[model samples]
Target: MRLTTIGFDADDTLWQNEQFFRVTEERFADLLTDYAESKHLKQRLLEAEMRNLKLYGFGIKGFTLSMIETALDVTAGKVPTSTIATIMEIGRELLQHPIEPLAHAAETLETLSGRYRLVLVTKGDLFDQERKLAQSGLGDFFDGVEIVSDKTVETYVRVFNRHGDGPDKSMMVGNSLKSDVIPAIRAGGWGVFVPHALTWAFEREEPPVNEPRFREVPDLGALATVLAEIEST
Candidate 1:
């Protein structure tokens, strides 16, 4: 199979992302500890994000502000203005978060860029993704960058079509099973599941559901090996 279009997921797949979110969450917990329990705050935030996804779409800046807004409303001035300021500072830090790629990210991209039609099929806050791409030095490797609201069946279908719809000749490599694996398979494309050693809790848990065209690997470096073998066949 000549792999014509190769799609990649950006977060934990290419660079460090959930780590930044984890750090920010820890800070957020500290700020709201006085108002609500940490667990309650976490649950409420998830609920709020799911609810807000309809309105704001997706992005870290909007999510962060929504969390703060929820805190303000839930606490009713008990969370001190300084805590809000601290959360804003944390948001700025997340925006400027260090963007180092995975162990073999650069070398792997370097090896494959000329060999395949590379596209970054990642889902996230558009502004956050743009920042990470600009900083990581790997952005230029992709022929196109897809900043999607969500990676659903339609997203994968659009990707395959945009790249001329040779689903069997295309493959998606990424860490998240929910966003990266199932959708690609649903679109009749191959999906490679690269498990991140320490993924954010939300991105970590997913049901396998016995998808035949899916393959699993430890991480992106391993993915490069898998793709090379696929090419050889």
Candidate 2:
């Protein structure tokens, strides 16, 4: 089927995102250096994030809370209030970090905007995602926006159906194979993996082997060509 809609993942796919989180994590490790070794601290923080995902969901607020939780755990509930305040301040800074569109992001979106239905299907803190999109200067290109809590097969099916034709006639492009590619493919859409350096471990997964609908590009610069090939197939 001809591709009618294209769904793009926002963070790390179109703009710099996970890099901020990596920096914050480094600062977090430094904060708890006296309590635990850097490796142990990072492991504990990852555990806290995983455990809290159900309660906190994704985004800076949840990450801040996870840092606090990790700090308290490592310190036996004795982590100083001042350190907690510092983490909160850094988290706030992260929330306000400037949105730098990736190389070729804008041009690629613009190239495909008029020809195909473009939808921003990202998962994060709704207000923060909205703020980033507003600041990104790319929001006007999208025919629809979906700041979802998570991406799943059902999510893609519903989003593509609502915004364009349907999943079979849609393509999802993003940095994480686990969330952005695999599920979209399972929903009967084309899944294009555009990798990023700082992807969260939880979002990493081996690409589907021998999958006719799965494609991977080094960056968004090569995306238009891939789309063209997919359409021809």
Each model's Cα RMSD: 2.1, 0.8
RMSD of 2: 0.8
- Per-residue CA lDDT of model 1 for 134-231, tens digit only, reads 99999889888889988887888888778644677788888888788877888888898887766644455464658767889876677777877777
Error of 2 at 116 (Å): 0.3
Report the Cα lDDT for candidate 2: 0.93
Query: Which regions of candidate 1 deviate over 4 angstroms?
Result: 76-78, 201-209
Looking at model 2, the pairs that clash are none
* Predicted structure 2, TM vs. truth: 0.98
C-alpha local distance difference test of each model: 0.80, 0.93
lDDT of 2 by residue, 1-233 (tens): 78999999999999999989989889988988899999899999999999998899998999999999999999999999999999999999999999999999999999998999999999989999999999999999999999988898999999999998989999999999999999999999999999898889999999997899999999998999998787777
Q: Native-vs-model 1 lDDT?
A: 0.80
